[model samples]
Structure formats: structure tokens, C-alpha cells
Target: MNRHHHKPRLVNLLDDFAFGGVSRGLGIFSSQIVADAADCSVVAVRPDALIAPRLDADIIVVHFPPNWRRIAFLLSLRVRNPQARIMHVEHSYTRAWEALKVEQKGRFRLMLRIALRLVDQVVCVSCGQADWLREVAQLPWHKVDVIYPHAENPGLCTLPLPDFSCERPLVIGAYGRFHEQKGLENLIGAHRAGALPGTELVIGGFGPMEDELRQLAGNSPDIRFAGKIDDVAGFLRGCDLVAVPSRWEAYGQVACEAREAGRPILVAPVDGLPEQVGSAGLVIDFTNPDALARAFATLDNQRLGVMARAARRSAQDCGLDRQREWARLIRRLVPRQARPIGVPVTA
Candidate 1:
């Protein structure tokens, strides 16, 4: 940076600033994390999909996953920003996802390995994800650092916990895109098996699987769809518990939000979810037909109250120092820029 603009330039390169956790993570990083330490900004690489001649930055944080087609682009990015420290934050692709979705595992791994070589450092969003990268992908552990999806959602954090003393039918809420990856089929199946008696399932959000999910519900009075939710905290507050049955989630933002809202969560032990859930909520193998219902069958007002308090405490624990992590990482990786102390004194 020039003497006039002395702060280090921390720029985020995003494939799409459209939606989803990856985009939201960039928003959080820009507003909360990097703003305090550097001159922060974002470049949406997907909108116009142009590779500029020069991207002026001292530290470039990448927010998108790499692919075979993007390999050339990544090489170009590295070549262009030779002076900057480029860090690729891998926000997608766990081994579980590759197992379920990718047909050619060997080829895919090669692509990832190639892409990773172009960046100076690799950042994973969760510890579990980082572990998988080191173990399965055979990436060097020295180059990997995990930074979980975190933010200050004051609305959810400040919300009053549900009054668990009320003897009412349990309300379990599900939110997010209606995708096969989310595995709502497992949750719907658990409810339909009559395993979840006297329980209500409220789902929100929209996607291609909307019709399939609704059809699976099949006129069940207990299962309802609230459509696309604008007020997430309000939606979370209405429920006694939140369920995330994702088959493969690298890191679950929904689970985090539920905890922040002072509501306990039920998550499948998939990818990084168990790590995020910690002791604050229930971790069941949603793939097991009877597992979810069995957990739900045991919940009483007393246990729910205990879990709610734990959820609040867990949320508090998560919010600690996430804002400062980026600054620390920049300091660790990027060379310090000399700042002007003042005009030199002429003797």
C-alpha cells in the first residue's frame, strides 16, 4: 500500500456473492473480521467472470471451492497476485459429499490437489473438514487452518429461550434449501414412520425439492411448510427445537443459528455438524430410521430447559474472538507493511 493508504488490503475473491453460507461468510468476514485490521473489499468472480489484469491486494482470501474448469483461472489468479498472500478457504466438499455425489473420486481428488497448489495456504471452515483434507485428500496439515462459520447475530442471540415448562406438543423446525444434500427425506421419513408421535414438523425455505418434500408429507396434519422465511430468528423462536438432517454438511450455519436463538438442535453426525453441536444439542444418525424418533421420544420439559441453557452458553462460546481471528491470520501470513510514523525531521 502507498503511504497515504497504509492499511493492508484484505480482499475476498468470491465465485458468487449470490447466496448460501459461502457468500454470507464473506459478508461476515468483510464487515466484522477484516474491517478492523485492513482495507477490506470483495470481487465477485462469477458475475461477469472476468479475470482482471491486476487485483491490488496485500492479502487475498478466496471464498469459493476449486474445480477442474476453474484450474486455469486459479493459476491466473496466483500469477496475477504474485506479491499478495493468497489463501483458499475451502467452503465446500467434504469426503462424505464426494462419496455420495462424485462418481470419479480419483479424478476429482487430482483436480483439488492441483487447485490447492496455486494458493499459499488452505483454510477449512471446520476442524472435521480440515481433518478430512489432511487424511483423505492427503493434504499437508501444516498448510491447513480451520475457521468455523461464525458471526454476531444479535437478534437470535438476544431472543428469549422457549418456556419449556409448558406441556405442549414438540415443535421441530427445519430450514434451508430443499436439496438432496440437505437430506430432508430422512427427517420426513422419521416423522411419517409414526415414530414421532404428538410432534409437529415445520419446514421453511424453497428449492427444486419443494414438491418432493411436500408430496412426502402427504396430507399429514402435523407437518407444515411456512414458505421462504424472511425472519429467521422469529421462525426459530416459534420452535422448541431445530433439526438439521443434512447428509453432508461441511459446517452447518442452521445449527449455529438455532443455538444462538437459545433453541436446542437435532443434527445428524455428518461432517462438521457434531463439532458445531458439541454438548448444546442432540446428535443422532438421521440415517437410522428409528434414531431421531427415539431421541425425540425421550425429551421432556426438564431436559429441554437444560438443553436450552446449554445452547445459549454454547453460542456464547462460539462468538468469542471470531472477529480477531482474521487479523491474527493476516499477521501470521502477510509481511508487515511499513507505516509512516510522521514527516521526517530535517536537522
Candidate 2:
């Protein structure tokens, strides 16, 4: 059996596939590079021990969050697939989120350590997240790799940046799940205080907090709720400014999409958001009620136009070269094909 003649089999194990960046990134991976590089498939699996049996592949990439109770499931996976290269993609869990949510710090840290040992490598979506793994989780730099989220929009570069040269109310757009983690309330708080006097704030998405958020808006003509937008580009195209006021984000997908459309983004200084802004937009204390208002107050037509152009340039610089990065990662992880286990079937 000549190993040089065979390509490695790669399986992406997804546990939580709700509406967010983790699920979206997997969608991109399926189409972008890995599928072309090797025999690749995306499979959804539960964290339960019974379902966590060794996946049939040369490489198994885990796209799931860690749990203390699932330590047995993880260990069993490694034990069963002793010959396979295992990797975990950390799409969530940052230093700020842990501080805000996890009360038992020591126990949580121990759980994370146990989980990390089960996999050969970690795929961090943002540089900031990798930094957190090193600074807070004490994970070695050698064990992790940073691959930023990227999307391919053909006409984004040609689309003109949002024009404020005409006399119209500033169209400020925010889109994502209406969850507390998203920090939509911070944006609403600013709009409610009459801080953004002439701006039209359009928020697109639905979640558990819909009714509550609607009530907070309270019969205001300027604030509108756009339920479940399928066209993210169309949404960004209509806006003068985009807001990503996440309390904790592994990487801001909307921030990336907004940049692709040449729209200036306003992101909170939390987790990977400031890293996403990267001089293309503004990074501020956007989560604070007072600061949120002041943040929007400083933005004018001239400043926004400058940022919009910068956003387009930033997106151009990033491009779709990440496809190559993914291919390289897979080839580096498993240099020689050990075996071909199974072909991917949709579940």
C-alpha cells in the first residue's frame, strides 16, 4: 500500500449547530477547501458517550464546546481512535465570557484542561481567542492555531460604501440573535435615551428576548425589528453603519460580513471584536449605556466614509486565502494517509 497515492479522510464533528458562527464556519469549511483537499464531510454528533464513539477518519475535527461531564466521552474517543489525528475547534469560550458566566473558576479550568488533553491540536477562530487560551487557560502556544473566519462575496468590492453625502437619517443596523450574550440591549439603551436623535436603528433577528426588546423600543417610529433576514449582504448594503455590540464573541461573523460589504462596523471591546475592528471601524465601551450613546454621537458622515473605505481595504487584504490555510492545516496534521474508513453521508 503506497501512502503517497492516498489522501487522508477528514470528518468535522459538530455537536451544537444552532444559529451562530460555529455552524456557519462549518458551512464555509464544507465548501471552501477541506472538501477539495481530502475526503471531507461534516457530521453532527451529540456529546453523549454513546454517540461519541470513534469517528471513522484519518482526521476528526471536533467543533463543539467542552463540558466536565463529557470528559469520559472525549477520553473514550481518543482511546478508540488511537491512530487518528484529533483536533478541537474552539469557536466559543473566551476570558471575558468565562468571567461573566462561570462562577466556579478553578473547577471550570480543570474541566477545560481535561478536555484539551483529549485532542492533538486546537483550532482557534480568532487571534484574541488564542491569546486567551495562552494567557487565561494556560494552554501552550504550540498546541493551537489561529484561522480567521472568511467569506466569499463576489460583488462586495464593487458595491459602493454606504453613502451619507445625501441628507437622510443615519441608518444604523444590528443583526444577530436577540440573546443577552449579543448585548443588543446596550444598543437599544442608547437609542432610547434620545442619544441618536435622528438615526433609524434597524435590528434584524429573532430570539427569546424578542418581546422584551420590542417593549424596550416602546412605540418608537425610529426603531424597527426586521425578523429573520436571509440576505445579510442586502441588509448591510442598506445601512450606513453596522453595530456588533457583543458582550463576548469568539469571532464576530457579522463584523466580517459587514466588512465584506464595505460597511463601517462599530464593535464592543470584548473578546475577538476589537481584533475584528482592526482600524477598519470603531472599538469602544459600547456595552455601557452611557458610552454607547457617546460612541454613536462622535460618528459623522466624513468619519464613517473613511472607515467604510478602510473596511473594504481590510476585507480585500484578508480575501479567501483562508481556503489555502485550511488545506495546509489538514495536510500538516496528517502528512501520510494511514487508512480510508468511510464516506460522509448527511445525517
Candidate 3:
């Protein structure tokens, strides 16, 4: 129950291995952690969950769903590796989310409390999310920490910046489930209302809202769905701008990816999206269709080029702080003997 004096083995746990932002972020973190410590691995609860292949080969992986079997497994782990520090990143909940699901609040809070008892820390991806964890979820403030997910995409970083001066309709890329939370409906409405004429909207993702979204678009040639995409870097490369019009976002990885790709982004002024966008992209109140359209209509080649370059510079300035932060945290968990020197924290 107490923090170990020696370098402790670290085990990161997640509810699924699905190819979502959280999974990718954890995969990258696990890989980085293993490079610094001899014993670091990840455990995905579902055996059939789709995991990121990029996870380091040496990092051990375990699969067990949350049940009595998992409790027994954790008990075994606690016994076998007494000094091991286990941490769980709560990727799915927010204070706003709790407000929306009033009936489930009691059970959700209980689950969070019980889950926290099993781990050394509860990592939230954004400051706003940390606030929700500590205040709304009633997690001990000390147990919650904000660790922003890395925005750098290796594939996108390696690609050359596309020609922004080309004579073509400016492409606006948006990737997320066609859900109300994502504000994609608002985006479609703004487009359909002729706010962003002479431009194309390319959406890359699938969900329950797909049918409804398509119905909203209603034979609009300017709107195209690329289905679920695997290569986000390639997708960004084809676009002049990226959009993150979420009603609420813990951390907008798409905004980061857009910045990393040096493409200007238009993000809803909410939560982590604004924090990520900074001065590099336009932040509009997507809830109002007119405001969203006006923001889109103002984009010109000159402004787009300037913002794109700013985005790249912003991402560069942030550096790989996530690695260093992880290193510092992991060092505190275990003794000096287990901590490797110069673990190459950079990706």
C-alpha cells in the first residue's frame, strides 16, 4: 500500500485494446515506460480487444476482463511482485458526462471509487478531466494527475508538408464518431446552410449517428464520408484544414494531430480543444450554426498557411514532455536500482 523505495515494476491497465485515442496513447506510454524500466507492461481487460501493434515487443501484456477472475489475478500480481505499482487511466468519464447520465451516477461513482482502491494512481488526460475526477467523481485530489496524451504522430511527422498554394477547393478534415457529442451534426448543418461554399468536408469515422448524419447531409456533394480510416496521417496530408467540433472533449488528439501535421485546425471552444489549438487554429462556438459558418468562411490561403506553420511550431515547442513526466513518475515509484540511466525518453 505504501510507495516502494526501490525502482518498482509498472503495470498499466486499460478496459479495452480498441484502436481508440486512449489505447494508442497508452500503447505509446507503455512503450516509453519499458525503455526506462526493466519491468513495464500493459494489461488489456478484453482478450479480443484490438491493440496497437506499435507497443514495444519486450513489454509484457496480460488480458483479463473485470470480474472475480481479474481480482484474483491482481491479488496474484500483488503477491508475486510486491513492489509493483499499478496505475489505471480513466479514459471514459467526465463531470459533464455524469450530469448527462443522472440515473447512473451512483453506480458510476461507486465503480470509480472501487477501481481507485486497486491502483496507485488515476491518470486523467487533461486538466479539465482531472478536475472532474477529483471534484465530481470525488476521487482524492492527490490520487489524480493530468498527463496530456502525446499529440505527435510518427507517420504524419515523417511526411512532407503539402503545397498549400495549390489551386483546388480547400479540404476540411474531421474525424470522430458521427455523434452529437462530437458536434458533427452542427458541422453538417453549417455546411448545408451554405456557410462553407466552394470547399469540401471529409469526415473519417463511423458510429450509430452515421445514418442520421447522412440523412442530415442529404445528397450534399460537398460532404463525403471516408468511413473508418486507419492512416490518420495520410488523411491529414490530403486536407488543408482539420476540424475538432466536439461539444466536450477531454483532450482533442485530432487538434494535436492537425498541429503536428502543420495543418490549420478549427476546434470548438470547449475543454481541451482550445488548450490544444492555442493560437494555431480558429476556435468557434460550433453550437451556433452562423458562428460556425462565419469561422469557416473567413479561412483564406494566406491565413491558412500562416496558421499551419504556427501549428507545427506549437507542437514542436511542446516537445516530448510526456516522456519526461512519465520518467519522473516512474522513478518515484521504484528504487534507484531498477531505474535505467538515459532511457531515451524521446519517441
Candidate 4:
């Protein structure tokens, strides 16, 4: 039980537990935040593929059906745990909108509006997302708080550092969902223009743009696609540097994760990425392929080491402790309330 303050019982609402950076960060924070007085529960909209086995015994897991039954399930939860503070962690607009769309006509939207209104606090992982909740979803900005995701140094314990000391092939790694927003196509163009010798580009992760990116990589021996990696830290550890060429990012979790893994990162100055990168990594204008290529050419082992150290230092600032502080603030602002039995917290 967290003893720093009177920890409030919290129910975290998540869409699913997929193997993404956002999910991983939420899992880590949830587990650590409730270490003292706070009792925690996780309600997944659907069955979770990646379960956090380290969750405390007091933490309950409830999986609801994908359809309309979710409302009834949540209603029952409120009846059972009237004192629990509901924390809806919005990860995607698609999932949140879909859930909101379930009610007939505009009533669903109204219900969703009312539902979030009941929450003690709504947490959005990125500022862009917080904006979306306010503008697109019509959630009040005052109720929605931006809690940037955090990552811990994996250290040399689980993942061993690869021998990147040689003046060998310069490995440039780009990781993320293979979607249009990732800007992988632009990165490919930059790599082609740069045409730097002894440079190898490896893109990791799977998404809709797999075929497009694969074709763009061509049959060139210098470029390779490693596909989706289960152990991101290990993959980053083996690479010389990481790149985030996102067109628009709510929060570039890849950049933060790479930093936490003690790897140098090059990111497009998009959304919260620049704020996330700070002075820790290189920020490039992704619109210009020639400039991106030139930036890639300049990256050497010595430069990588300096950036890696800075990245680690930056990551430390957004660790589990920082998240707990946010949690404390949320608790203080909202306090606790009593609700009717069997009535949904949102309703």
C-alpha cells in the first residue's frame, strides 16, 4: 500500500493489453503506483494478449465482451466498488470513439460525455491526445490531464550491449506501427539520397505499410526489414541508432523507449517528440530527405555514445516515480465520492 498519501482505490480502463509501447508504459506505471495504500483493478475491454504478471495480488482483472455488454459490466463494477476512482486512460481515438459510438444515435455520445464526467480524472498519454479528447471527443480540458508515458533503463541485466565499436556498417533503425503517420517512406527516400557508404538501414515493426516499405527498401543488401520485435530493448541494443520519422506523433513512445535503452535517437520534430527528445537526441526536419540523409551521414560511434548517455539521463526524469506524483495530484484534485449501487460510474 502506498503510504505517502491516503492512496485511493483506482480502476484503470484499458481497451486492450497489446504489445505496444503505450501498453507497456501503462502496465509498468499501474503496477508501481499502487504499491502502497492504493488498491488497483484493471478492466480490459477485451481479452488481453499481454498480461502483466507482476501486478499485486489485490489488483483484480476483469475482461468484458467487445459489444454492449461492456456497459453492464462497468455498471456492475461501480456497484461492487463504489469507492473506487475510475481512471480512463485513453490510448487511441479509434477505440475510444468506437466505444462511445455504441449507444443509439447521439445518445451514445451524450452517455460517453456523461460517463467520463463521472471519472475522477481522465488521463491522456500525450498532449495531442489531450487536445483530441477536448476538441474531437468534447471532453473538458480541465478534467483531462496529460500524463506522458515513462520508460525505465533496461540496463545490461536482461539485454547485453552489442559490439558496436567497429567502424563497420552504420545501422539506422526505425521502429513503430507500419502506418502512414510513421513516415517510413520519407525515411527510405532520405536513406537513398544520403547513399552513405557502410550504412545499413533496418526497419522493425509490422503494420499496413509493410509491403510498401519492403518494396521501397528494394533488394539492396544495405537495407533490411526485421519485422515486429517482441523485445524492443534487445533490438535497440543491437542497433547503432534509432530513428522516429513520424509525420505527427501524439507522443513518440519509440523515442523515449530507445532513450531508456541507452540508444541514440534521431526524430522528426513532430508533436511532442521535440519536447520528449529535448536535448537528449537529434531533431531533424523530416520534410527534407537531403537534410535527413546528411544528418544520417554525420552519425558516428562517438556521437552515438554522447547522445545515448543524454537519452538515458532524459528517460530517468520520466520514470515510475514521476507517474506516481501525477497520480497523487489527480487524487488530490478529485478526492473521493459515493455513488449509487449498480449505476455505471460514467452514467
Candidate 1: misplaced stretches above 4 Å?
A: 1-5, 47-53, 151-154, 317-320, 338-347
Off by over 4 Å in 3: 1-7, 30-34, 46-82, 104-118, 139-141, 158-167, 317-319, 335-347
lDDT of each: 0.81, 0.80, 0.68, 0.62
For model 3, residues 164-213, the per-residue Cα lDDT tens digits are 68888888889987777798988888888877778899999999999998
Per-residue lDDT tens digits for candidate 4, residues 1-347, read 32243344444546657766555665554555634435555655444333222222222223222223344444554455544444566554432334433446355455556556545557676775676556645776667777776645355223433345775887778878898878988888777666445778888889998999888878878888887777777678677668888777767778877777666778877566777666566888766976766766776667766777777777764676556765575456545423323333331
TM-score for each candidate, following the candidate numbering:
0.92, 0.92, 0.78, 0.70
> How many clashing residue pairs are found in candidate 4?
5
Candidate 1: tens digits of C-alpha lDDT, residues 1-347: 33643667778887675667776666556654567677788876763443533577778887878887677777777777776778889888896898889998889888888889888898898888898887756688788988887745558988899897776778989999999989898899888887678879999999999999999999999999999977888898789889999999999999999988889889988888998776678898777767766887777888888888899888775654566676777778865765333433121
Mark the 10 consecutive residues where model 4 has the least summed lDDT: 51-60
Clashing pairs in 4: 1-36, 1-37, 2-36, 2-37, 115-346
lDDT of 2 by residue, 1-347 (tens): 43344577788888777766676666556664666777788887765644366566778888877887677777777777776789998887897899899999888888888888888999888888898887656688888999987655456666778887889898889999989988888788878887677889999999999999999999999999988977777777778889888899888888987887888898888888888786678886765667666776788788888889888888774655677788889899988664533434221
C-alpha RMSD for every candidate: 4.1, 3.2, 6.9, 7.3
Q: Rank the candidates by lDDT, best first.
A: 1, 2, 3, 4
